[model samples]
Target: MATTNQNGGNRRPRGGRIRAGSSRRAQSEQTELHLLRTATWLFSERGFHGTGIRDIADAAGVAVSAMYYYASSKDELLEAVMRRTLDVLVSSGEETLRDVADPAERLAAVIASHVAFHARNPRAAKVADHEFHALTGQVRQDILQQRDAYETVWSSILSAGVHDGTFKDRGTVARLALLQMTTGVAHWYRPHGELKIPQLCERFAEMGLALMGASREGRALEACDVNLPDTQLLLRRAELTIEPREKPTGL
Candidate 1:
């Protein structure tokens, strides 16, 4: 038999124990997600060193004790957030390029996926970009490891394109140039602005192919046509917003 709570929830008992661990796990996961969201906002606005554990706890509406239960310290929390951000980018890139056989198409897919991720996760992307100096020792190395792995995807694509005679700039400079250009979308993209997420991905994919010296004839660079997720939808999922900035006083 199962016990019913006041909220109409059922509690089952097995082996002299209640199935309360599932509920506890769900609560813990929710708390951790809130903490990550709060930290991403603070780090993007005030920087990693400027944000304190209490600030994150208060923003997430959790007690300081509860915050500590999830993240032992501010540095640990920062690393966790950054590590997760890079992990997401790496995983997304790999998944996006998995079925892309053509070298030019693979490069285009990488660019499109990168742009979408940044536009969706602006706060997390900004924190990852600006807070590298704040991490120390092993934490910095761990985050960079994930970053390098993600970069390798693009590097391999570029190398393959060059080998196939479809790309010309087969050097580190071209890779950094394309990456810097696409990653900058996080700083200026707006969900409800002039261009929607799909248009942005298309334009960015074209620009990336052009930067790589690939021919822009016809549909050769239309890599984002393979079902990339919308940036606005992803932003909504992460609960991050982008508002217009006010003009400076006496500008």
Candidate 2:
């Protein structure tokens, strides 16, 4: 039997379960997102060893059993968070460099993207940056591989700059320093703080060029005109929301 809904449209019979699949999927996604956000906050605040599955469930307003349905264990949840962060970082890096052919410009764009992502999603960045030690076995190896892939993006840019004489051959040291410097933004950047995202991106991009010894005046000028992507929008589209939490005290 069908019944008239508020819109004066016939509703399917209750036994039919017409909308059940899509409705359940949407609810599942929401629940999973909630769990991820909660776990990211807790892991960032308390460290992996300090946080437990029950803690994540309680904070997320879900039962432990329900949380288990999304992630079988805390390790799995941590892996998911880390993987999501890396996925965004890698994809954004690739997207930023797609049309950028000049080495100096590529390097600047990469730096800007890194800074923007870290500043926008600090907690998730912190977890991805600092919590790898807690993961063990296959998951740990997988995350490390992703980290290496991201590093390769930077390395290739640096290598190109060195090859083209646009940048000094500072080798791996420069690469590591640049990564550390840009990624460190996640530690201290605040949305309402004095430095805005665009400014930070420009300043950091300039600093990166300087660090690379890119002294070609015209090239440096052009390279600073990097187009930083909307990291917040990207994360939101990826279903990764940044939940508000207390300011981090220290590393």
The reply for model 2, stretches above 4 Å from the true place, is 1-23, 217-239, 242-251
Which lDDT value does model 2 have at 115?
86
The TM-scores, one per candidate, come to 0.78, 0.82
TM-score of 1: 0.78
Worst 10 residues of 2 by lDDT: 12-21
RMSD of 2: 9.1
Q: What value does the lDDT take at residue 1 in candidate 2?
A: 17
Model 1: clashing residue pairs?
Answer: none
Give the candidate number with the greatest TM-score.
2
Residue 218, model 2: lDDT of 48
How would you encode candidate 2's per-residue C-alpha lDDT over 168-200 as one tens digit per residue?
899799989999999999899987999988778
Each candidate's clash count:
0, 0
- Please give me the total number of clashing residue pairs in predicted model 2: 0
Q: How well does candidate 2 score on lDDT at residue 59?
A: 82
Superposing all C-alpha atoms, what RMSD in Å does each candidate have to the true structure?
9.1, 9.1
